[model samples]
Target: MKPRSTLVRILAMATAAGALAWAVTAGNQPSHAATGPVADAGPGYAVEDYGYPNADKILAEKGILLKCGDGYIVLADCASEQNLLRFLARDRADVCFKVTGEKGYLALELESVHGVRTSDVSTTHLEMTAENDRVTYDIPAKTWEGVGESADGREHTLVEIRTTK
Candidate 1:
């Protein structure tokens, strides 16, 4: 019902004011930690995000790469937990890791792993693969379960474990 000419003028004024305010704020120093955009962090600010910290140490000493995980389940030094997932390989006597959350994930290949222990509250899924064969498993709560050895006794490598809530 209002005049179109008057509406146009008001809108134009508002747009100009908003743009001017934006320009002014854009140049001003930020009042808080700039969660928006960083100027530049410079060289050596980069970090490896795919794997756990100090993964190299574990690989060199324990023969486990521990490339990456969802962080719910994680690698702990031996004897860190009352019970932990255990693997027996031809190359090593045992390899192990601890789980922390009700649901979690880990990606690794524990060669010739014959067994694993399960958490009390979470259901576990284990996957293994050989030259041309692949296998999957589900372990119930609080169980020390057999894996590659139990499943036809094949020397399969563990690829991934996905746990869910």
Candidate 2:
């Protein structure tokens, strides 16, 4: 009877040890199912494309096609603020932009832009294309300068505006 009891106790202990070893091995293995802090980590990372916000609305309403920008230079209401960078177009009304930071850049399409009035904050560079020819103008700060067709007799389209302090 003593030998039988001892054998039973040893069998129970061996079974318990096997179960614990199995549990530890299974726990150490990587799980396909998502759980715990890794699963609860919320959303993924965000990538910025630097596209102009509300560009479709502005294009539809104001006939100005704003493409991309560095976020420092933004479209603005001409009447909303003073010292805005203003543009003079052939058929369209004056378009304005607000400049911030040490440098700013904007790529857009405004047709027949003949002149530009740069703000007092920074010097502005205008890039335009006329009849397969690309032209660039460097305008001093706080000055109104002739650009595109205003400089040449041919019609020109404003393509980009870059500013630096």
Which candidate wins on TM-score? 2
Candidate 1 residues 49-158, lDDT tens each? 66767778877887776768878877765566666665656767666667777778888767777877776566789888976888899888678877886668667888
Best candidate (score: lDDT): 2
Task: Return the lDDT, model 1, position 43.
Answer: 48
* Runs in model 1 lying further than 4 Å from the true structure: 1-48
State, as a TM-score between 0 and 1, how close model 1 is to the true structure: 0.66
By summed lDDT, which 10 consecutive residues of candidate 2 come out lowest? 32-41
TM-score, one value per model = 0.66, 0.76
Error of 1 at 116 (Å): 1.3
In order, candidate lDDTs are 0.75, 0.90
